[model samples]
Target: MPSRTSRPTRRTALLCAAGLLALPRLQAAPAKKPLPPPPDVWPRPALVPGGVARLSLGPSATRPQAHSGELPLLVVGDAIEWTALVGIALAAPPGEAAITVAAPGEAARRVPYRIVAKKYQEQRLTVSPRTVDLSSEDQARYEREREHLAGVMATFSPAVPAQLHMQVPVPGRRSSSFGLRRIFNGQARNPHSGMDIAAATGTPVRAPLDGRVVDVGDYFFNGGTVWLDHGAGLLSMYCHLSAMDVKPGDQLRAGDAFCKVGATGRVTGPHLHWSVMLNRAMVDPALFIDA
Candidate 1:
């Protein structure tokens, strides 16, 4: 008997060749790109009517411009990334909605987003007939005010707000909520566009964020109202105030007392009607503030 030389079988050689063939494929495979971070939590994204939609614009060397139809949107973030904060109208029908985004040096493109339907509660109340059925003079005044407010709401300034999170303007009970289909007596009216905080008359109403007083006046319905421009298309309104401490062009820091609560407007009692408007749409103020 002689010692047989050890040799690889055909099957062994094929297995070795297969292993060699797999090495380059494993080595040449590229690493997967990382996902982006989530958007800011403030003005929490709610894809419904009377909600704020936070649409990520990805990264860019400069801030991109966005718009809802003809109305410009508030695009915030740095050169590395940008986001569009759009205010969904309370009357917005649920379905597909799109916004136009135009990055620097690039052609504008439309980005479609989905909007879920939301049903708000209806409220019935009994008030003076005079408030509900306006006189001819009051009607004319309201029309004028509406025209003026249209301009105010259309304001889209260059400055972006420092922070999206907001503090409550006053400490009190939430007497009324936004998006309520209010009915006075037996007649129906538009949905309540703001949050009403119940407080004693003369209670200080402070600014929730840094803003410039853009409009202050005694309106026909709102009484003593103050509008604060928080830069970009972000504006906050304080309505039914007894007194206004800040005037147009007056700059105010967060927590600065800008007005006092009152029952001056078409209200049953003293309360602060706080509203947050973005891109001319009156969104639910509760979205920006903690309830």
Candidate 2:
């Protein structure tokens, strides 16, 4: 009996094809960049508002989780020595508050802490009537943009941030206008949620730390805006930008130029409105900036 002619097996053919594909890929692949070093852990204060408080997770082999008033907090370090980054809201009442810390296979524990009252200054400014009172059409547009921005600010990515010590995005004098209750044209508005840096138009705005660009768009109030997610519910926003160098999904490293300062939105001059968000709450930018 004549034996059937030998044939190349499917598995053997697949191996040859895979080897051919890998050869070109290995030759053309670019060198991988080294990651930035982790940031130094800042000292956690006891009474926190514009600061962060640390909560001990105790001795355990498993990593722990934390929360402050229903808002999930940032937990860093290992099991043997874990600390919860409790971000106290600017409007958080100055009184007894508790943080819930839980570890795997253990009951959740509440760490009681107090928040001290911090008095913010008042600023009265009489801007143009159009800015204070938007027209019906502009108001509708502003509302729509507001909703869009709220979604951007609420982004929480799983990527853990490397450096927490952030550089000032733009080189200028950081105005003491943060958290100011402003009277715009005799109409009181929400307190200022960001730090205003006085800078000339076209000044290059750099990324304070490594992060991914989550959103970029021109808003009614924010004008040309860019939102960066530094991971673990830590977000940063740059408003009134003249131009953007990156878009959503773009990853940037510390000191990378990402935007330019401008008077694009509702602003009195060319400057940058930088806001830092922790656990979706807009906190003082001074909390993260080193210089």
Q: Which stretches of candidate 2 lie over 4 Å from their true place?
A: 1-40, 43-48
Among residues 3 or more apart in sequence or in different chains, the pairs in candidate 1 whose N, CA or C atoms overlap within 3 Å are none
Q: Pick the candidate with the highest TM-score.
A: 1
Candidate 1 per-residue lDDT, tens place, 75-162, comes to 8877777889999999999999999999879999988899999999999988788889999998998999999988888777899898
Q: What is the clash count for each candidate, in the order shown?
A: 0, 0
Best by lDDT: 1
Model 1 misplaced stretches (Cα beyond 4 Å): 1-40
Residue 216, model 2, lDDT: 93
- lDDT of all predictions, in order shown? 0.90, 0.81
